[model samples]
Each structure stands twice: as structure tokens, then as C-alpha cells.
Target: MPPTDGTPSDTDVRASTGKKRIPKACNPCRHSKVKCDEQRPSCTRCQTLKKTCIYVEKPKTAEEQKIEDLEQEVLVLRQQLQTQRDTESSIVVSQPQRLMGQRPPEITSPDSNASLNHSSPTWTSDKPLKRKRSHFRMQKEVAVPDFINEGILSEPQALHYFNSFFEGCDRYVPIFDGSDGFAAVRLRSSLLLNAICAVGCGISGDASVDSRILHVRLKRWLTTVILSTHAQSLETVQALLVMACWMPERSLILAIATRMAVELQLDDAFDRLVNLSISRPDTPETHILMKSARTWFLLLNLEQILQVDAGNLVDLRIKGVRRCRTLLNRPFSSRLDARLFSQVELNRLRAKVNETLTSHSDDLLQAVQEARVDIDVWYQDWKRIMEASPLSESELPSLIANLTVQRHWAEAMAACRAVRATGVHQVEMMSPEAHDMLVIAKEALQNHLYVMLSQPHYLANFRYAMDFVWAKCAFSFLLLLKLTILLPDVARQDLLGQGRALLNELTKSSGYGSSKVYLRLLQLTIKKYASRDQTHSGELDAFIPEEFIFEWDFPGLNLFSSPTGWDMLFDQYMIGDDLFVGMDI
Candidate 1:
């Protein structure tokens, strides 16, 4: 079957490449790029395609691969030679004569990958120090998603923890803008992300992250951020507010944040709010402005409370309703915002009342009347807000109600303190501010005790709420003690019984250790007085003990002795001083 001109049979057709006949690939199959398998006869592709298979005997070229192999060999030799040099240098540095006289110190090569800059301490010895690790560890290979910050959390984990914050905490304070860009910016800052997640874990009912570890990390970062030159970010201020609300032992942080906020002029940003047309609700720029505004207000909200309780003059004196109404008319007027506005106003008045009480003016009566007028106006405005744009009774609203009642009772107590002094046993003969003090103090003290004793479970709120309520309760008890004999028979016995019950409950309760001490003081004082009064001739004849000195705690603080006009320093020192040293603000 061979062709006439010495050609091979049909199976050998189309198999030539240049001068060589191809053996491994059939010409047709090789052109189509399928496997030829180099079988003795026909390969699978050649058989399937019914084409000719050819064989070539020339060797293929491997020059480029040979050069790559040589390069790799040289690199390995260089590394080995460098390592040998390092070993020799180390050996020379640690001669046996040097080792014989004293113990040898561990020598580390400069090329070692151990962390040299980490502040976590390392104990140097013959053995490596062991470390205890819990759930979190830094995986150097893991990277955050493009928008997220570098380190500690992968994309999925960051998303998972952020949801906890949105669900639990954001309901009360709607500060975040909640857009995609906002989220990206939020996750991009490592300092802010740690703080936000710490607060989230602290509040989250279902969260498994160890909140204490994250909280400790936040405090460490806070030291670097707060005192740094770049501490002007609004999110940083917001995180501070969150910590001030939820964290225990926040006195130092709270003071630093307040000073930083004022230095940054966050309070002044309120006046420059853009018009609604310029700050459209959906725009990114508007969200930035709104967040700034909210940050300013939030600082005011927190600082007002702290300043009042700390016996400092109000740093923020903006009482005009027109500005808040202007803001409300623009892009921010939810019920939550309205309620916060009301509270900010109310707390400012509280600061003024606090100023009057702590102001040791020679004209004390004049100061009291001025403070009383301001307080009456504050109450009127609160009533106005309630009737006009009343918020629904959410959990925060109920807490605000409790705060209002405490403020009312506190103002009454302060007003009576300006008028008179009397022994604990003597009040009925002349009723000046003396009688009013007993009545006001008794209501605040007696009612708080009875209600708390009856419920016994209301102390389980976040630390902010419980701190406020307990302080009010303690102040009430101390006021009644100052005029214990002046109290109605019913009030005295009720406090005695309820105080004992509270002490017993606190023994099993997770309340502050400070509260336990405060209640015991009250209970012990009442026991001594009650036992003596039982053995005395007349109510007035029982001599009040001088040992029963009045001392009580304010909210979130240790016991504050009676005020002696420390607020005057605010006027003297803070008039025009700027504490910003190297900071841009």
C-alpha cells in the first residue's frame, strides 16, 4: 500500500517538523494540543482523530532551566556563608574565659525574627519565657479586608463584632452615620475600632469576646491617643463618651476627654451648622457634619452631669433653645435627639444649681434666689418639651425620668440647705429652711429606700444609671441623718428597716463595694440613735451625738465632704488659659 514516490503508508502522513520526523506527537494532534502519550504505535489522540503518528530522535533544549538552577544554587550558598559568619562572630563574643567568671547572657542575632519593639516585657534567662494566651492572638499572615484596619481581626470577624454594637448600644444614642463610607472609615482606624468593640462586648448579651481584654487594650491605646498631638478626631471623643457611660473608674479619662473636647472647639462647631440645603441628609459631607454636631452635644451631655456632681461650674453655658430648635428643624430631629437635647438643657441647669450651692458667696441669699429662678425655668422647659415633642417611653426615657425625679429632689434639698441649721432632735419650734430641709431630705431618702427595698432588683442597670441613682439615695440618707430627730416617726423607722434590708441584699448583690460601706454607715447611725431614743425621756431631750458627722458619696465618685466653694477656681483659673501644648487644636 506504499505510495508510488517512496512515501510511507497513510499512518505516517503529516509527521515531519523541519528536518526531523516527530515521534512523540502526531502532526494533527500536536497542532491541536492534546496528549499523544508516545505509545509504540498510535497514541490515544492520534487513534481517536484517525491521524498519522511520527517519531523524532533529536534531543530537546534545556539551557534556560539550567541557568535558573545555577542561580538558585548561588543564592543558597550565599545564605549558608552568611550564617557561618554570624556563628563565628557569636562564638568569638562568648569566649570560655568570659563565661567562667559570670553567668552568660542570652545572645540574639540581629537577623532573628523575634519582636524587639513590643512593650510586653520579656524575662531573659537560659529558658524561653512561656506566655498564657486566651482566644485572641495576632496572626501575622491574616489581613483585614480592604476597608478595614490592619491587624488582629479578619474581615468576617470584624463584621460579626460590629453587629453587636449596632443592635445593643446604638438604639439609645444614634450618632453613627451608618453608610458604607462611614463604616469603611470607622474600621480603618485601629484605635477607634478597639474602643467601639470593647463597648460593644461590654453591652452585648450574646457576645463571646472577652470584654475585659478588649477594655484593657482600649485603655492602653487611650493613653497613646488622648495625650498625643493628633487627639482631635470626633470618633475619639465619641468613644470616650461611650467609655465614660459604661466603664467603671473613669474619673481620669473623663476629665482628660472633657479638656480635649474643649481644646478641639467641638462646642464651637455647634454654632456653624450648615443650612439644610447644603447639608442634604444623604450626602457624605452632611453625615460628617452631623456626626461632629452629635459629638459636640454628646460631650455637653456627659460633661454637664460630671461638672454638676464634681462641684465645678458649667463649662458649657449655651442655654438658648433657638440653636437646638434650628438644629431640630434641619436634618436631625428624631425623638432620641429631642430627648437628649432636653437632658443637655436640664443638666446645664443642674450645673448652675450646683454652682450656687458650692459658691460660698457672702450674699448667699441672693445666689440662692438666682439659682432657684434658673431651676424653675429649667423645669418649665422640660415640661414644654414633654408637651410639645414628647418621646415615647423607651428604656432610656424611663431612665431619664428617674434622673429627673432625682434632680427635682436634689434641687429641693439644695434650696433648703441655703436657709438654716438645727440639731438632729430640734425642728418643730421654728420652721425656716430647717423644716423644709427635713421634709425634702426625708422624701428623697425615705422614698428611695422604700422603693429600692421593695424592688431590690433595680440596681442591675448599666453603671451610669446605677451610679446616679445610688448617689441620690446616699445623699438623701445623709441629709436625713443630719436632722434625724427632726424626721417624722414614720420616716425614721422606715429608713432603719430599709437600710438594714439593703445592707443584707448588697452582701449577696454585685453592687459597688462603696455602696455597702455607705449603707452600713446609715444603718449603724440609726441603730445607735433608735436604741437611745427608746431609753430617753422626751424626743427633744435625747442628745444628738457629735460623732454622727454628715458624709455621703456623689455619683461615680468616692465620698465628698460638704462643699467649701471649690467652684470659684473655675472662674479664676480657666478664664483664658489654653492647655493645648503641641496639639493642632
Candidate 2:
């Protein structure tokens, strides 16, 4: 059996061991009893003979099977744990609908017929089993009635509204920054999509459903679903801010949105980003950081303006409000950024003026001079940006610049009103304050006339939902009406005629409810004056109600402020006062 050279021969060794050859051979090679070389796909013999080669695997051992089953079970447990974690993160809890005196929205599950626990011991039992459900449901349950399904806005009509929003509404709001386009927005948040459509419907005036009704429906859905769940989402904040700017219940909705943003830590991010020294790279995280930061800045700007418009003084001592200057000083910021900063500065100056006037300070003239100087300084600081080329996406620069100038004119009127308020009631026709007020009022009215004649769309369409726009126009008309009656000798007849013509046009063309009320007052006031002049020729003692003429608390009288002093006026004019209270449809 041993070889001659002290090694065994292959044939002698195999014969002595009595073993088969090539145990690892492929099926074809093994069947032929040939060496296989154990190649992955084929053996040398099979390749040479042109035959199909296949390998037969041995059965797995018991321990290996058990290990695989355990791994699959771990994977399933991990998925269930992740689901539980996600459910815990949301704000919704059990039976929240019952707390609101409403039933929970019903949703049908696709896996209704499948057993949730097939491994349970009672899987085949006929006895009833207790159903298990999540402690909270974060998914959207209240569905927005499809405007398209309701035949309010068709697909093409919705496209038109979307286009209108991107073209115009986005310029003012700028909330949808770095959006991936309409389809992506639609896929992400239907609440935001519907809010855009409703605001656009107000601007475009093309919807079959009344724009107010659309807004009401959207508000209902937002409160029922988004607010009820306390959804901590950036899209929810954006939708609320947009509605606050364009719809009723502005103050309350704005407060809620600001609170939500604070809760979401946007203010912290805003301060941090404003203080950062190095530039951030182009990443998704950077995009989100920039978006949240910019939204916070936008919210602050809106708050300042809203407070000033409501005749409330804003405390600029807040750190976040002060950061506006730091961001303004940042180089290479966008034109919109420049505009936003300038608005904040301008509104800040306006609040200062309101505070100075409301306090009845002794040095009123000096305070007015200081406020005017501050406003002019702000204008000079942003003058270059204001005159720069229009944005690539919009022509908002020119529009905003014009609006700033109009606001400046309104500010001047406010200053004049303050000066006149200090003078005597009798012999008021001869007072220098009266003359000064008339001069500024005439200029403001002429500017509005110019805008109406040249850029009708600005007033008629893009700004239809902005209450301040109508408020300013109404205030100017009221000033002209009251001043002409007081100073007939100094009244400019041509300006009065032009103001009446504009009011008539607005009454006919505008769809806002406030516009109709102010224009009707104009007609009624003219009739009152005419009838009084005919009956009492030179007796001007009881000509017009002293309160009506002198009271700054009346609606449409204060150009830049809402009426917060009179309950009757608020009740009669502020129709949407309760819109956001209980979120009633």
C-alpha cells in the first residue's frame, strides 16, 4: 500500500480508504464520478462535455434555523418599538374629540379583516377578543372637503389660483421658501395647499365659491384638525400666518401662530442664525435652519406692524426684535430681506411716534421732529435696496417701495392729527394746525388718486384683502370731507371732486365689506351737510355731531389704526371678531 519513495499513490490510497471521489463535485460531475474543481457555476468536466451544471445544497441544521427565526423576531420587535415611539411624540391623546363636544373622525382601516395577533393562543377561538388601538392618533382624520369635488374650483381653476399665489401672494408672505414646486407642496401638506388656494381666490376673484366662504371652510378644517391636535409642524405655522395676514381674526390668529412658532423653537433658531459668524453649507439642515430663521423674522415684522395698526405701542427692547438690525447689516442679503428689515425699522419708528403722541408729552414738536428724522434715516439706509432692480421672481420691489412711501404719508397725517388734537375746538377753522392737516391730507389724497389711475391692479386685485389699504383710502376721504366743511375758504374744490370720484369707483369696483361701509358714510355725510346748509344758513353751532367729527375712535377715521375705543363701532364693523374664538364654521 505504501509508495516506493515513502509516499502513498493516489489510486492505492483511494482503494485502501474505500471512499468515493470528488465529494464536492457538482450534480452532473458527481453523477459522472469525475473531479469537479468545485467552481461556482460549473465544473471543468461539465464545461468540457457541454452539460448543465447545478449544485445540490445539504439540509440546514436545527440550531441554524432557530437563529434565523430569532433574528426575524428581533426585526419585527424593533419596528413595533419605532411605531410606539412615533405615536408618543405627537400631541393628540385619547378622546380629545369628546372634550370638544365633537365625535372623532371615522377612518376605515385597509387591514380590517386581518388578524392583528396571529401568534396569540386564542387565534382560532370563536369568543370575542378585546381590540387594541394606539393611545393617540396623529394622522389627519378630518379631511378637507375637496374644493374640486365640490365643484368650487376645478383642476384648471386650481392651477390658476396656484399661479396667482406664486406670482403675487408669495411675494408678500414669502413663507414657501425653497419649495420643491406645487406638486411637492401638494404631496406634503394639503392644509397649506388649501390655504394658498383660498388666499389666491381672494386676490384673483375667479373662484365659484365666495372667497370668504372658502376662507371660513379652510379655517374650520385648520382648527378641527391642525389646531385640535396641536400639530407642531412648520407647515401649520405657515398656514396660520398666511391666514392671519389675509383673513379675519388677524390679531388672534397671529398671536396663536407666534406662540406656536415660539413653541417650535423658531425664535431660538432665529437668534442663533443671526449671531452665527461663518456661512453655512448647502445642505438640507441648513435649508431648514434658514427657513425657520427667516420665518421668525417675518413673524416679528408682522407683529410690529399689527401692533402699530391696532394703536398699541411695541416694545422694541426685545432681543429678537433688535436682531433685525444685525441681519440688516449682513452683506449680500436678498432684496426681500432688505424690504423686511426696512419695514421693521419703519414700523418701529411709527410705534415711537404713537407712544410720544399718546403720552401727551410737553415737547410734542421736538418728539415729532425726532420721529421724522428717524424715519428718514431708515429710508436712507435702505434707499439703495429700494431702488435696486426688481427681483427675478417678482416686481415687488417697486410695489413695496410705493407702499412704504404711502405709509410715510400716513405717518405724516398721524403727526398732523396729533398737532390738531391739541388746538381749541372753537375757532378751529383759523388754526394753523387745521391748515397743516389740510395740506398733508390733500397731498395724501392726490397720491392715492395717482395710484388708482395708473396702477389700478395694485389697489383692485393684489391688495383687496389688506384692510389697511382700504383703511388708508377711507381715512383720506374722511379727512377731506371733514376739513372742507371746517375750512370752506381753504378747501380745494378740485381735490374734493377727485376724492369723491375715487370713492364712487371703489364703492362700485371693490368687493370688501369695509369699503362699502366707508363709501356709504361718505354719501350720508354729504347729504347731512347739504340738508343742514339748506335749513340753517349761517348757524354752524349744531352743524355736525361734535363726537362724530372729533372722535378718533370711530372706524375708518384713524388711517393706520383700528378702532379699539368704541364697542358700537367694533360690533357693527368687525364682523369676524369671533371667527377664531371657537373656530366656528
Candidate whose lDDT is highest: 2
Which runs of model 1 end up more than 4 angstroms from their true locations?
Answer: 1-188, 203-210, 227-231, 247-251, 262-264, 274-284, 312-314, 319-322, 357-377, 390-400, 416-431, 444-470, 477-486, 495-585
Per-residue C-alpha lDDT of model 2 across residues 1-585, encoded as one tens digit per residue: 333332334643463456444235565654555677888777676678777776544445699999999899767765664454455434222322321122333322232322222112121223466778879866555544546655667778767777777765565675455453667656655666778888777767674757788787787776764435434456667777878777657667777778777666566655445444245444344445555666776777677766655543434324535456554333324446655656666666666677676686465555655665766666665665555534422545455545555555644555554554555334333345445544555455555555664555554442444555455556555554544444444444565566656655665555443444445555544433433422222212212222234322222232222222322212322343321232211
Q: What TM-score do all the candidates reach, one by one?
A: 0.52, 0.59
User: Could you give me the TM-score of model 1 versus the true structure?
Assistant: 0.52
Worst 10 residues of 2 by lDDT: 114-123
RMSD per candidate (Å) reads 27.4, 21.1
Q: In model 2, where do residues sit more than 4 Å from their true spots?
A: 1-153, 178-180, 225-230, 275-277, 312-335, 389-397, 400-404, 420-457, 460-464, 487-491, 504-585
Candidate 1 residue lDDT tens string, 334-413: 44565566667677666656556556645545555566567567656555555455343343444445445544555554
